[model samples]
Target chain A: MLDHITQTTLLLDEEKCRQNIAMMADKAARNHIRLRPHFKTHQSVQVGEWFREQGATGITVSSLKMARYFAANGWTDILVAIPVNIREMELVNELAAKVQLHLVAVNIETVQALAEALQRPVNIWLKIDTGYHRTGILPHSHEELDAIVALVEQNDMLQFTGVLAHDGHTYKQTDAEAIRTIHHTTVFLLNLVRDRYKGRFPELKVSIGDTPSCSILQTITGVDEIRPGNYVFYDLTQQHIGSCNFNQIAVCMACPIIAKHPERNEIIVHGGSVHFSKDSLMGANGSLIFGRVVELSENGWSEPLEGIEVVSLSQEHGTIRASKALFDRYKIGDLMGVLPVHSCLTADVMGSYTTLDGKRLEHLSGMGQL
Target chain B: MLDHITQTTLLLDEEKCRQNIAMMADKAARNHIRLRPHFKTHQSVQVGEWFREQGATGITVSSLKMARYFAANGWTDILVAIPVNIREMELVNELAAKVQLHLVAVNIETVQALAEALQRPVNIWLKIDTGYHRTGILPHSHEELDAIVALVEQNDMLQFTGVLAHDGHTYKQTDAEAIRTIHHTTVFLLNLVRDRYKGRFPELKVSIGDTPSCSILQTITGVDEIRPGNYVFYDLTQQHIGSCNFNQIAVCMACPIIAKHPERNEIIVHGGSVHFSKDSLMGANGSLIFGRVVELSENGWSEPLEGIEVVSLSQEHGTIRASKALFDRYKIGDLMGVLPVHSCLTADVMGSYTTLDGKRLEHLSGMGQL
Candidate 1:
């Protein structure tokens, strides 16, 4: 299989990916919350279909383009999880008219824009920031929350769906206990806001998610839905965070070694930022690791070779520093597998993937727009 | 102009790009070296036409696919600057058969592979390592050098063309003198190797390039051709290296502000790693700047706003920390331009760009295959 790879090719372990999806879906089922797995990670129709096989009906995407792409593929319910872009009201109207669309609104302007332009009823989630501080209305900003609630109450086309919070702070916490704490705190804050509006809007739901929180926290409370995307293909970052075992990483980039530097114990592979997306994490040795090198076989790649890590990356070149023994095992024109540091960005950069069984999976990246 | 930019859009200033090309072409002419600008930066037929307008007959690319794409657009000369991937020898052979193709050979195996697979004469450049330590045969690897020379001499399908050295180490140096020293040292080392082989192959040319060295050094000597790609679009990295001024940055990502947090003085934009790439640099205040925020206008974006910087990026969201004045000037629906830290990676991630005049350019990325 490595012999045929001439350039950087993303390889997916179907069994591993299916297992990861099933585990997360089962977790959501046991918790009795909807598992609307974020489709922004894999962005593949086939992978989305796999979620359907495991009984997932609702899905979440980050862009209007992506929501339309999936909705066109027969997905009935979709959520544009990011704060809605009011400038794209035409696309918003078209998608909402086609499917059960859910849009996020973090401010009165966003809510008013959606309310005024919306020709059909669309579920609107008030995005509340629960200490993530990336993008959302503060959970304690009752004045802003009530203003949005008032707008939704007046607008017949806009339905108050729930409070959505992405506990992105969990990504920075390496300790599983810390991640759980952040998750619980985020859920508590979100529930506080949900309870305030519960009497007025009894159908309100609370959605909180981020892969680290969803994977590490054993029990989830007061959340109506989970939106974990990277769990479908956990990577080195997740492994270092203790969220998943090494075997759970489902995606690896197969790159051809174009040059070997024995003296430096380094090999230059034809995979770089365009393939890996420049995402990195700290390794056990306190150095930055772009990826971990693994030996490739016909079935799949072996466990990451000891002491071999992708140390640096340029646009189309990745430098792997390895132990002398491992360096001697490879030659020029050889192929190696790299378990990416962040699989979500890796999959996004790669645009698509080739399953172990040679099936092609397409994504929004393959749509080919400038 | 920013109203329709609901998502991340790469905006190119055509006049700035044309000026950048002409200045470099004139510099190469004055230095009396062939100007074979690297095409991997823009990767667009329209952009290549601009280079052609400057009388650039030779171009350098990093991949066979790019060579084929440019060749289809009537670019006759292309050097695939990266080390030769023997697995793609069929592609190498086909491309070499069609145009004035040049391939880099770093070791005996690469030369031997090309010798064994070649059906037509192709120019072969020996890639020399002159402190970059990325991917090349060490300049002092006399035994390996002689072996490759011997292989080229024995093969009728291979022509001993020249020595190619990419002094990428200059990029890390901020001092002008240090950059000049690296450039001079690299050229001196490459000349030593070339002089030894000059008696055996009198027609051998010496090629050296890196945007920092090419742009900063007053004089370029002992190199037959220069292949600086990033000079066509200097980025924040170049500005810090003293290669180009901020005004020389021809490309900027226009992204809509989807959410704002006045308390944190940060706004969320639709651009992220997928648009600007994860490359970053240290700001004046010692914070990591993913990109510098600029005010958008009809002609172009204003100078990068002081105290406003893109601090963090996720898959589809960039968090910009800004001064209160800068944050107040924009609302949730407004757009801002972000000057990337590294233009090469940004352009590569964006795939293609839209000019200020609203003309769409096509790139190899638009071909859209995994």
Candidate 2:
């Protein structure tokens, strides 16, 4: 099955993935904290093993299914990073019985509900709004934290896990320098809280996760654990945001050139938004193309195919505007590779992987999700 | 299972689907032709039943698995609309043996290959390029048409089913009138070829597809069957193209507002490029924000969420910026239904559906393509 696969697939470079693990492991060790990398980005067991090999003892996931999956695969400490919704109590109890389940609570109301509802001992983290206004109770709001902490201390069935923050707000700042400055200030602020509640919640873990910050770490401050997943497959959007260099990018999808319409400055291919998903687009073109169509070289994926500006994509057809020079180079049945603007969307939609050498394998992340 | 099903899911208004079917059925009756609606768009057994109730005896699919799935559920005549990629010869042979399988061939070389490769009598449709140069034998090129006809006549096992042309190029026209003109000319040109091949291939069926033309047509002409799948659930892109108006759209994903980040004018939601795939961002503003996120009314889906602009998206989070009015309207835990630019891409990625009244069910279209 591996040998039979060819074009129109995701290719993951094993060596580069291992390199990313090593880099992240070193960063966590230097910061004197644990590394609980999130599995939401690259949800493959093979990739999960890469993190484990590099000393990832704990992990974070977006859903209960993900937590159960990793736990069955030998991931003992799992954090369900989403706010502990009251409706998911049964699954939480089941998971708590099996592993050290770490649930996130956004407010005192949610914290109180979890404290009253849980039937078994479980660790829970207080979500702090360190400025990602998307979720979490604000650190400045002492009333909110005091109420949550009071309820947790009263509940014998629930263990008080220290505060945790995910500065998802970092992804919004188009400026890379501004992101770093905010991240630096975030760590400084968290350390202040750690000292403030030093004895009350002794050894409380103050964690941080923002792929951009972790991947572009010139300095690691007081963050206890670092979670960055997209570094496994760097994409064009990441490049624009100054996260990972292009050399670190490991996956590419190879598609075929199926048609050429001379009048529209476009050719059609079999790949479309179905294969690539609506992701990042060509700047100012305002079309739906989400990747750079590139030449598939003997070594690996190469330069963007000249004249082939992937202008638009329909459901099953990719519309390419071939540059005058590349128009002649392209024929009806030619093969080309595309570097997706967002690899997470690319890998998720394509649903399978092929190594650069063309060995294909199932993308197991979706299997667990389903 | 039914009670907690969230609004951020595929909800089918079965009533609207039937009306869409009846409308297309009426077009076929008025045109005095057959209708072979493609199943690639709304891949639901229930949707298929609606088409059957409206008197569709034939269907079309993009792959062999799709053909087999439709056949197993009792669709006898199924056209594999994709160019006959002989790589799946075994699957093609298997499907052809059990059902009336129509295979698409554009080049004379492919016709020759079909004749030599399969021992079974395969129904063949020579794809005529009226204008969409994606995949078809050019009807205007007499030499190309003559050569294909000669090959088909020479082959014993190949039975020429018809000359089929999907006027996909009609989609690129600037306005609805231009699209209609392209559709009219393309159909006329194909009918001209039906005359040229009259003596060579008797009992040949001529067909035209491209939903924009067919859906907008108060009357159809010069074709035996109409294959327009997107009409089942017209999208923003379709409505903008003057295909079907807003009230005609039947399917929409109900996504939730997971966070409200007004400072960035963004509300991060759970659905992203993965669910919506990459689709065209169309509006007067010309600022592409991945897609149009709409407000959900109690009766049905509504217009783009007022003052909320979908600016950027990560793998699972669509970040929207809010106008002052939007910020005032949105609260945490609010649900906003997004109307995708392309319904087919969204439908394909979502892979399952729930009714507006909360009935979860499997989607029939995929048939395990992965």
Task: Provide TM-scores for the models.
Answer: 0.98, 0.84
True contacts kept of each: 0.64, 0.18
**Least accurate stretch of 10 residues (summed lDDT) in model 2 chain A?**
A361-370
Scored against the native two-chain complex, candidate 2 gets a DockQ of 0.28
Residue A99 CA displacement from its true place in model 2, Å: 2.6
Question: Whole-model lDDT for model 1 versus the true structure?
Answer: 0.88
Model 2 C-alpha lDDT versus the unseen true structure? 0.71
- Name the lDDT value of residue A317 in candidate 1: 87
Give lDDT: candidate 2, residue B369: 32
Give a tens-digit lDDT track for model 1, residues B109-128: 77888888888899999999
**Best model per DockQ:** 1
Chain B TM-score against the true chain B, each candidate: 0.98, 0.93
How is the predicted docking of candidate 1 categorized under the CAPRI scheme?
A: medium
What are the lDDT scores of the predictions, listed in order? 0.88, 0.71
